[model samples]
Target chain A: MTTRRSVLMGTALAAVSGLALSAGLAPATAAEKELNIGFVGVTSGPAAAWGTSNVRSMQVRADWLNELGGVKIGDDTYKINIVTFDDQKDPKRAIAGMEKMAQEGIHYVVGPNVDDGAAAVRPVAESKGIIYFPYAFPKELYTKPASNAVLGMIANYQSAPAIYKYLKENKGVKKVAFIAANESDPLSQRDGGVAAAKALGLEVVAQNDTYPNDTRDFTPVLTPIIRLKPDLLVLSGVSPGNAPLLIRAARELGYTGLISTETAHDAAVLKEGAGELADGFISVGGASTPAIRSKTMDEFIARYTKKFGEYNDESNTKVYALDYIIETLKANPKAINDVAEFKKTVDTFGAPNPYVKEGTLKYVGTTSFGQKRQLSVPMVVTQYKDGAFETLFVGEVD
Target chain B: MEQVIANGLYLGAQYALIALGLTLIFALMNVLNFAHGQMYVLGGFVTYTIYGQLGLPFVLALACSALTLAIVGALVEKFLFRPVIKRSAREESTMLLAAAIAFLMDAIILILFGEKQRGVPKIINGVFVSDSLVMPYDRILVGVIAIAMIASFMAYMQYSRTGRAMRALAQDRVAAQLMGVNVDRYSMIGFALGALLAGVVGGLLVTITGVNSGIGGPISIKAFLMVMIGGAGVVGGAIAGGFILGMMESVGLNVLREFGDVTYLVIFVLLMVFLSLRPNGLMGKPWG
Candidate 1:
């Protein structure tokens, strides 16, 4: 035992034994440190596409993380689990879903895609001390400093100004007509657009507040606006189903003026709905066109399309949210149960940071939502051309 | 102004087609078929299945939808309505029955076709572009087809044996029964014709506006409004009401723009006025 050779042999045996012990305990450690994330949104109604895309993307992200030996936090690895509730786009159901998730011990949550659901679920989430990532557009949700919710998508304030600026600088748009569906979010979006257009010195020649969701013939709505002969026609905050039909109706009515929207509808859907008429239309989000997407975005889109049969703009938001959560967890592994620490970490890091390799997210906190919780990514104005959305401009708003 | 008129007239025609079905059912059965709009949506989906998914000719798809709905309508009358009619307390029971049918149809549609809006290729392309106005041929075609179908229906109701029997039943069911008219047979035929009209309109609307399952409720409301404004049991009144409502929407939106969403409020006001001043509606006869 005193010899140098004996000492080396004993040390080697101990190292091997330690390695075996760690290997034996790894499964138990992983089983003990499970993270549950909840998603509450419309998954079974007319707006099902939004929730379907959201859940599928999150699932894909979770699967990828689990495959890579789970999320690493200091010396521990935790398995990521995603639990979902379908709100069917109803506010009462959204609150019920949030309560159910809280009962299930989920502290992290995402979704309530539209305004009503988001508003209804906010207080419930805050009361439970849960971190909520909402895809809604209402600024009031984030205006309160003590709220546990952060907007995971672009706010109407940012989108409206960005869109108006693009139209003014690039298209030389002057007079504008605004139209939207007769829902709370759409109305809010229209008001934002009206204010933005006015602030930018564009005259709002015509505006319509109410178009029903099931409206098949937009001619009654579009004809009057076309008659106004404005330099720009704005269809803001309409559902994916209504947006394209509006475009087709406008084109059929023979208005060649510029058309734009801030709605994050899939360009492929717009193309399918409006066909060749979709060409020359401007919109936010870059899901439909190959020109604006990064290589990583392309791959994600390919995977998403293979799984979901289609790609939507909301998919990008879901992926970014998951990436941000994962990155934040990695930065402060001990922040898992500490809500304040997690919020501080997210607030300090901001966005547009490197997400999954080759992907970057930029979130800006605007005064519009009171606190800096809204995700403010650079606005990408895309024009549909030759059966694809061509990137026209990428710029930021004041 | 010309464009506004054209738009209103076309819209009116569509409303009339949908309302005519509701009026027929009310006239014949003394019960409102709340599921009428679901029938319209189902008709569109059936046409979409035939024309869009199966690669059939559009007209043939329309014909198939109309025929299918006619059979469905007859079955509904024979099985669902006939039993309730025998009970003879249609006010509450039939209302419940219609609502149940509506829910059943909506659930089935949601399960089958999904909530996505389905588009049908325009039967004809191009529009009549002028200095003052633009009109799509699809709109014009819908108007023409509706007018032709309504005219044909009026002729049938006035001349055919079944048509006379239906009118007699509408006037006095007991009297018609005494006159040896087949009440049960005419009721089934009335239901079939009503559903047939909805199917045809639904098929046409697919080409003009596209179709989704969500179209049922709003359409049902509008159809009901048209029936009430035009007079509950009067076909002519239903047509007039549909056109008036269409014109009001077009002109109101044109003049008021954003304020035009209150067009429905205007309709409601007019409805109240009509109820107070002319309770029987524009063309409805007194019950006595």
Candidate 2:
């Protein structure tokens, strides 16, 4: 029973079984070469849903591409391997994650999802020639002299003006109030939204209502904000988790004003947290609603839910980042390592968006960052009703 | 102003529930349990599973959460803390262990519960509106439950034999041992009680703000602030600290609404100044 031949056979069988078990976890075969794409972001902590969505979407896409016999770049076909790093929402760890990605020779990265992490990894991404698509909204990150960082989705400043103008024009909204978490991301977004509100000539009734991230009770916070009695209340850059709480608090306090956020929100979460109270709550609800979702989008949602056992609506926008990376690399194979080449193709590069039937994949942000440094995520603002999102209006990023 | 007081009282009731468990453990063992927040989170998640997922009654879910956390606390005290304490007399060792435990619990929480913010259906419907004062019925129920729990805990600690033994141990561990009090059993019980209190608060609060793995650390930090303000290891002081922090937050947020989000910073500064004057806190004496 303990013979060397038997043990060797057992080991061989075990190795084969292990490989078979890890079918979707890694590239299924050694026949195909691998192209490593890095994801460095907070996969844990309070802002987890955002980064988690980013990672899951990329992984599903990578697996899908690999299943389709890999992506072609220049003359070679390489299996897309997503390398993930959980920075735990710490900027220092995000830097370390970027360094680790660089050491692995991965040139394209998906995220450093928050403002601090996005800023922290800038030195590493630039120095290492890593073209990172960060889901962060710092203007400095996407502006000139910051060539490598691309805005992964529509930022608050970009989304707010579109949302505010629509509401003002449609709902006759005159007064706007802004509230934010004391954190940098929310504070920045709040300030950006305030500027946008002022630019639209909407009267700023309340501007500096902020609370700590860990605050559970919002009655005290919102009472003062509600007293201003603006026609609209905006929670700037609120995390997906905190949005419902703020909404619920505001609504329960009998403030009949319309409430909105420029950040992503989960309809299911809103329903569960605020119930029927969250009806008419507006937020950036990604690029598609059930009404506008294409076949490809439906398939992606089904497969993602099957694989990960859950799907966040935020992932609808997140899938675009990796798709952009792979498509850009195919356009200019040299950009696999050099971000400058990627930049050169940004204005000219165009492809059919896989998520939508009639949508074209292109770069935007000419108006926001003075360059095509943002993905043209169809700015779909939505209102939460029951456990689903109803598309309010779809605007294009300038 | 009425709204501020109402908010404070509501906030204070919940905060007191959280601080009770933390202060109780600190009183008996002087272990500044960094993992206390994780325990509370664990409780919330457990309740969520039972109530939100399994469709169990809310009362049953709360009870299960309490039971689960008590067992967890007892095991932690018996295996981790007791072993570490017997092996080493250093306070830093226990502190390190607690931090390690917090990280470990966070990891476990991530693995068991995905990073999604989990919430339950509103236990009750309707709103209570009287002039400028607006409060939800669910919130009122939670506040009442929290106050009831605190009162029950106080009564138990006063009337119960186990409570008296725990008090004796907290007063003087060595002296309690010499007086034929079973130190190890009582210590374990105290730790369990502390963890149970945390669980109860977590379970109750999950109905309101929801629970995520990420909130544990912050919850613990908040609990620490309450303990510091009220005086560490002082149960009454912990309750007092909770109410004080709650009142300050309520008043500060409204009064200084025009001053941006500087309420917490101002409170922190004021607290620091207060601590400098009375190092033992308002009601605490050293480890009180």
User: Highest TM-score: which candidate?
Assistant: 2
Per-candidate DockQ values are 0.27, 0.74
**What overall lDDT goes with each candidate model?**
0.78, 0.90
- The global Cα lDDT (0 to 1) of model 1 is 0.78
List model 1 lDDT by residue over A1-398, tens digit each. Answer: 39999999999999999999998989966467778888998766457767766787888777777877888877877788899998988999999999998898887788888889998988888888777888887767777654577787666677778778777897799999998887788888888889999999999997664676656678877877787889999887877778779989899998899888886666656654677887888777633345545666677777767755556665654666676676676777656776677777765664444333223454456556545575545456677775566777765532
Which portions of model 2 show Cα errors greater than 4 Å?
A: A1-31, B286-288
Worst 10 residues of 1 chain A by lDDT: A350-359
* Candidate 1 residue runs with Cα over 4 Å from true position: A1-36, A43-52, A55-88, A208-210, A286-288, A292-314, A322-338, A349-357, A361-363, A366-370, A376-378, A396-398, B83-90, B172-186, B258-260, B285-288
**How well does candidate 2 score on lDDT at residue A392?**
96
Q: First chain TM-score in every candidate?
A: 0.86, 0.91
Lowest lDDT block of 10, candidate 2 chain B: B279-288
Winning model by lDDT? 2
RMSD of each: 11.6, 3.9
Give the alpha carbon lDDT tens digit for every residue of A316-383 in model 2: 78989889998988999988777789889998999988786568889988888988889888888998
